[model samples]
Target: MDTKRISYLYDRYQSNSLTALELEELGMLANSQEFDSHFEVVFNKIWEELKHEEVHKMGIEAEQAQVDFILSHPRPKTRRLKFIHKIVAAAAVLIVVFAAGLFYRSFQSAQTMQPAYAIVPGKQGATLTLASGKQIKLSDASKGKLANEAGIEIIKSADGSLIYQIKDAGTGTSGMFNTLTTAKGETYQVRLPDGTVVQLNADSKLSYATSLNAAGERRVELIGEGYFDVAKDKAHPFIVKTATQQIQVLGTHFNINAYADENVTRTTLLEGSVKVFSAGTQKMLVPGEQASTRENQLSISKADLESAVAWKNGEFVFTGQPIDEIMRLLSRWYNVEVEFKGPPTKEEFEGTAFKEKDITEVLELLELTGAVHFKIEGRKIIVTK
Candidate 1:
């Protein structure tokens, strides 16, 4: 496009004179393959010179300004103009260069704007709530009797999870109940009265009744992450409920991850079969299949059983996910603050690391991707250019 034509488009866009379709066309022109390199150069100018005061207040406008400016000016006309025009054009070039520098600095500033809250994993030595509404501390003696309710006794096994089983012969009906909770850095396992087992992950809770002898279905509540091996009792089914999902099973092994901070709640089946219901929808999951619920929609897809359940077995895995997302997961599990000190780029990572690895070692391995640099000061990780 000629200088005059480009200038006209620039003015129109700067003043919001273009229609929606025209704006889209302008974006297409600005983001064209040939203009990709110089796109930022043009964007900085329009954003600084023409962006409205109110528009500038919105956090997103800086990015929009960059896009709009690129469409407004294609190339400089320094070679064709007279001395005075050339001088004016030279001054504009200097201004554009100066603005680019400021944009880069501002981009650096944007990286440090961290989320106020983080979803963290559970720690060892977490507490549990008994059927009597009694809270028991788990740090000292590993094994203890929790409670007896409805002819069933809830006990903490030598291992971390709570177990509910029938205690004595009884003619009347009775049930036991207990809940297991983990702090920000722990994992625990529980075996139900019906020979079913559950592994509780960090920052997680599981509530279950003691008696499988009841005529009704077996039910449990989950908060964070857990792997369940439901014992088969066709007459009595097992049901696991979370904030947004429910899993019903006759006899199956599966993992439910419904951490509040996570955008999606996932149910991964390992063996047998399960019916996952949520958001007014239901789907049966076969072994090696997974169900994901996001924004009140449920989707089912085949999955890798070993990879999905790896956390229960003690490992961390990433599957071509963005750096920021990976950092968020790390922050939760390790209980640390993650801050970035430079420009943010769309970079993804794929790898596995042991959950036992310290925060520094994990950051070092991530730095190997040449995508980010990290400086760890105690529990805080500062990401840099």
Candidate 2:
């Protein structure tokens, strides 16, 4: 309960070295009657010092190795462990599960329902910088031009989307570098110079080289959600990169839900072909097939394209989906916190609703199935019997 023990457990948690027994004990202490309130106070203070940004770059194996080590080696009980250690140990366990998957129930149950995890959607907007280091923030401004950057005019449409075109130059090979970011609850569509139409979902960012090079393939890094309708370039393949997975495609229309908070990176193909690779695993998805990767494992199944892309079309659709999974989807898009008040039920729902529907209405529909109930306080949804 003191700082010393907190430091020890914090170190072990960061390094992924806490044993299963220690982790369970830590979980208990976090939600225990004696220390629940003060635990959060000490845990947050120490967490700021121990946070690491470099962990995202490592492969899935490294994460698993850490988890495996913890489960294999049990540490001895130490009265020396601090109270702060116990609180943070609880948070660290949830973080591990999130990186290892997308969601976990125990952590969800421990928190009071609030919109702690919800985020607002990002609209179509960007800042373009010219070669001269001058910047332009696009809106309905400057004739939708991002200024002439290296002789390529960076243009934004009325919809706040971006595109690049050569200006006052022969078939010269010149382009401008730009980045696109989407906030929570928003989505945008863009046609790349290569004719690839990319639909970026909320809380996602993408950056591409300004000029398309005469190269082996085209590559782009993704930090959130996006749907790709790639223009077929037989000589050049399109590659989508995430923190832990890579998706390669020729010409295809597919949606990728790979939010950093999600436990799995899902690639659902509507047409053409996509090959998903992670660590030592590879799975090729054909039209109507979907591939999902979690903790370095692969799963592929026949998919309903309409259901996969309902969000892009401004709707929510679930067909015989489990309650836990449905909560995951709602948590991200609605940007609300979820707390389970009891043991998870044997309940699942089949329904559809427009994204434009009031959050309460959607919850009402779920309640009709007689499986669950929801409480809304501001942006939070508390799950109850």
Best by lDDT: 1
- lDDT, model 2, position 36: 39
Give the best candidate by TM-score. 1
Off by over 4 Å in 1: 1-124, 144-150, 168-177, 212-215, 340-345
Lowest summed lDDT window (length 10), candidate 2: 76-85
Residue 229 in model 2: lDDT = 88
- Candidate 1: lDDT of 371? 57
Model 1's lDDT to the true fold?
0.66
RMSD of candidate 2 to the true fold?
A: 19.2
Residue 319 in candidate 1, Cα distance off native in Å:
0.9
Model 2 lDDT per residue over 1-385, tens place: 5545544654565565887776665666545554433444454454454343344344435554654564465432211111122333444543333333212133333223223443343245444444355656554355566556444566677666766675644432334345666655556676676778888876677766555432467777788888898989988899988876789987889988888877887789988888889767888888899888888788888887887898888777776666777776777666666778886566555556767654654665465334566666677677876
Model 1 TM:
0.63
